[model samples]
Target: MYVQIDLDGPAGTLRVSGHGLPTVELLRSPGAAPDPLVPLGTRDPARLTLTVDGAPARIRPAKGRLSRRSYRVDAIVSGTRYRLVPCSYGESRLTRDGRPLGTLESTGDGRVDADWAPGATPLDQALGTALAAAFGTGAQPWWQTAADLAAELIP
Candidate 1:
C-alpha cells in the first residue's frame, strides 16, 4: 500500500493515510514553527499514531544532541524498534536495530518514493519517513550529494 501525506492547513499538521482506514494525523507540536516544510534547523519533530488490525504502533520523534542529528522517529511495534535516518540526496533511511532496512526518497514530481531492502515492509518505511524528514538538518553531509554535484558541473 502507498502512503499519502496531506498537508492539513488549518490544523497546521499532516494527515497520513495508508495501511488502514479514514486517515492518521501527524501533529506537530503547538510550539513547533509552522511551515509546509519543517525547517532543517528546528529541533521539533512530528508525531503520528497507527493501528493495524487491533494493535497500535507509535511513531515518536526524538531530537539528537551528540550525533548533531536533528531528529529521529522511533516506530515501535510489539517491542521491535525501527529508526529513521536522513541520508544522501534528500533521502531518508529506515533502520532496524542499526541495520539498513529501507529508504524513502523525494522525487522531482513532488511525490514521496520508497525503496525497501530484503525483508522490510512498506508500512514501516512509510512510518519512518513520516517523522524522519529532517533531511540531514542537524547532521553532517553524506558525501554523495557533494560528489554528484561536483561531477555534474565542472568549473
Candidate 2:
C-alpha cells in the first residue's frame, strides 16, 4: 500500500513520502486503519497554517485501505505543526526540526496521555512505549530527542 501526507508549514512547506505510516492510534479513527507514508524527501513532514487558533485542518491521503482512525489528525493549536496518528487507540511522539521533542501515548480508550522529556525528549519513545505497553507492538521509528528533550535527558 502507498500513501501521500502533506503538511503545510510557515515560510514554505514540508513533505514526506515513504512506504508506510506510523502505527500510532492518533492517526486511526473509531473503526478504521489507514496506511501512512514517509516522505523520502530531504525534509521532515511539512508544517501547515493550522494552529491552535485556526479552524480544524484537513489531511488528504492517496488511499484509504488503512483504518480511518489511522488517518485522524490534530493541530497543536499554537505552532505550525499538525499531528497524524491513530485516534481511537494509539500514541505519538514528536520531534522538532528532526529532533525528538516529546511523546503522546494513548490510554487505549481514545485518550492519549503525554510525557515529554523535562528538557530533551525522544521522538519515538512515547509511541513505542505505548504500543508495547498496550499490545506488545513492535516497530521502531528513528526516534530521537530534540534539544529540549536532550536538555531534560541530560541536564
Backbone clashes in model 2: 52
Location of the lowest summed lDDT over 10 successive residues in candidate 2: 39-48
TM-score for all predictions?
Answer: 0.57, 0.28
Each prediction's Cα lDDT score?
Answer: 0.53, 0.31
Pairs clashing in candidate 1? none
Best by TM-score: 1
Q: Each candidate: RMSD to true structure?
A: 6.6, 16.8
**Candidate 1 has what TM-score?**
0.57
* Candidate 1: stretches off by over 4 Å: 19-24, 30-68, 107-110, 132-155
lDDT of 2 at 135: 21
Q: Quickly count the clashes in candidate 1.
A: 0
